[model samples]
Target: MKMVFRWYGTGNDTVTLKQIKQIPGVEGIVWALHDVPVGDEWPMDKILAYKEEADAYGLHLEVVESVNVHEDIKLGLPSRDVYIDNYKKTIEKLATVGVKTICYNFMPVFDWIRTDLFKELPDGSTALFYEKAKVESMDPEELVRRIANDVDFTMPGWEPERLKKLSPLFEAYKQVSEEGLWRNLQYFLEAIIPVAERNGIQMAIHPDDPPWPIFGLPRIITGQDNIRRLLRLVDSPSNGVTLCSGSLGANPANDIPAMAREFAGRIPFAHIRNVRVFDNGDFIETSHRTSDGTVNIAGFVQALHETGFTGYARPDHGRHIWDEKCRPGYGLYDRALGIMYLWGVWDSMGTSRKGVAE
Candidate 1:
């Protein structure tokens, strides 16, 4: 696996490219023009600026975490065609910078949902937490207010400006059912996959966080069967899945290692992390160690190795350890630690296979 780190950009992220360069196996940055609003064609100058920065540190800018799909596209509005065209243009621009994979999601309104950004764990280190009961009971607006006000930095999906019109966004999605959402997603893929294919960029869709419908919003990209359906939508190598472990692991039914093995050829990018699920349907992000969380991270890495995966992968999220006051899930210390744990598993698997062959 070719490891990468997600850097929000120069001023946006607390972790610097210098610090990311110090990580042993990381060779690239999974990045995007975060300031670029969704549905707008990315400015070539901004894209080049990121390239220049990564180039300065000898880090390849080959993977983008998200080129966020607009709600118009997800809702299948008439204006979606314009946004889809803009998406195509953005793909072309990113391709100019040697970006191999563009990760995007089709989830409506919120991209990912969590009850607490810094929920304290038993060990005193905090991490992103999802409380099912709390989400079900809370008002969407209240949840937005709490999340937006609490964080000093802008949350990717929960952009305060876009979410301010929560009532209308929810009302717009009311016309869309799960099947309708699937059809809309297929429409999007059919429109953009050809552009992505021509640009030599694989479009990977991140699975819905928690892998379930939240606050009555329809979530289609939830598991293996849905993923299979998604792949069939475009039926092209350019159309792929991000295969996020923490997102699908929340469901408990997703066989992540099997997914890695099955979709190995198609997946050009991966987000590998661990989350500990509880009897009460809650989960907290944990270290990348296999034993720390419910996800079979080691087995997942083993499957990647067995498949001879040369695609980009990253330590998705880490705990807020060492009193590091950084982004909720994206921190330096724990993520770097997670990377070492992943390397340990991957390298050991390589040695064991070599020994067996000898």
Candidate 2:
């Protein structure tokens, strides 16, 4: 596996590209033009500037975390064709700078919901927490106000412009059933996957955060069965998934390792993180060790290794530790620790496989 790190450009992120290059085994950056308005064709000059910066640090800008799908596309509106055409242009531009995979999601309104951004852990370090009861009790607008606390940097899916139009957007999605979401996603894939194939870019759809419906929004990409149906939607190698352990692991029923094995070739980008789920439907992001969280981090890594995965992998979201003042989950400390843990498991697995081969 080729490990990558998520790096928001120069001023937008606390973690610097120079710091990212120092992380052992991290060869690439999972990035995007976060400032670019959703559905607009990315400025070629701006795209090349990011490449120049990563190149300066000897890092490959190989994977983009997201190029968000506009609500028009998700809502199956007539304007979707216009946005999709722009999306195709963005894909072609990204290929110019050697981006191999584009990781995007189809979640309506919110991308990932967390009741508390800095919930205190037993170790005194804090991490992102999800309270199911809180989700049930609060209004989504209130939740939006809470999550959009940081005015300086914008979160990928929670763009201020989108959230500001929440009422109409929510109304637009009210008629969309789970099947309708699937059809909409199929329409999107059928339109873009061929463009991605032509450019050698794998279009990887990230699973719905928490892997279930939230706030009355219908979620189609939640489990293994949906993944199976998704692969069949376009039936091309360019069409794939960015299997995220923490998102799917929130629901204990998901067999993450098995999904990794089953969708072996289709998954080009892997987001490896662990979540500690409580009996009451709450969860907290934790250390990457399998024992530290409910999600089997090592097992997921092994599944990738055994399946002959040669794609990009990244330490998804890390906890806040060591009194580090950084982005909630995208900190430098715990994520670097996660990478060491990943390398430990990955190298041992490779050694064991080689021992058998020899």
Candidate 3:
């Protein structure tokens, strides 16, 4: 597996590319132009600038975490054609920078949800936490304000500009059911996947964070059968998934090990992280070690190795440890620690396979 790290650009992030380079086996950065609003074509100059910065650290720029889908596209509005065209242009521009995979999601309104940004842990560290009861009982506006105030750093999907208009976005989504969401998603894929194929770029959709509907919003990318059906929407090699463990692992029914093996060749990017799920339905992010969380990260990686996975993978949300005050889930220390754990796992697995071959 080719390991990558998420780096918010120069001024936006505390973890520098210099620090990222020090990690054991990280090969690239999962990045995007955060300043560039959704549905707009990215400038080629900005794309090239990112390439130069990554190359300075002897790193590759292969995967982009998100090219945020426009509300129009998700709403299935007639103006969606304009946004889809811009998306095609954006893909064309990203291809020029050697970006192999583009990761995005079709989740309406909020991209991901967490009840607490810095939920304290037994080890004196803190991590992102999700409380199911709290979510079900809270108002969407109040929840947004709480999250906005949770951390000083920017919460990626909860951009204030988007959250400010929560009422209308929810209203727009009222008419779109789970089946409607699937049809709109199909419409989006049919328009853009061909352009992605032509440019040698793979469009990998991230599964819904928590893998369930929230606040009366429809969520379609929830589980294994849904994923199987998603692949059939476009029916091409370029149409694939990012396969995030934390997102789908919230629900106990999601067998990530089976997903890792079944979608092996199709997954161009993998977000590997662990989460501790409670019998009460809440969950918390944990270290990559299997013992620390309910998710079997070691077994999941083993499944990938067994399938001959050679795609770009990254350690997902990490705990805030060592008194390091960084982005909620994008801290440097814990993720670097997580990377070492993953390397240890993959190396041992590979060594055993090689020994068996010998």
lDDT of 3: 0.90
What local distance difference test score does each model get? 0.90, 0.90, 0.90
lDDT of 3 at 111: 92
TM-score of each: 0.97, 0.97, 0.97
List clashing residue pairs in candidate 3: none
Per-residue lDDT tens digits for candidate 3, residues 62-87, read 89978999989999999999999999
Which runs of model 3 end up more than 4 angstroms from their true locations?
A: 351-358
Candidate 2 lDDT over residue span 207-325, tens digit each: 98888889899887899999999999999999999999999999989999999999999999999999999999999999999999999889999898888888889998999899988
Q: Which ranges of candidate 2 are over 4 A from the true structure?
A: 351-358
Model 1 clashing residue pairs (backbone): none
Q: What lDDT score is found at residue 24 in candidate 3?
A: 85
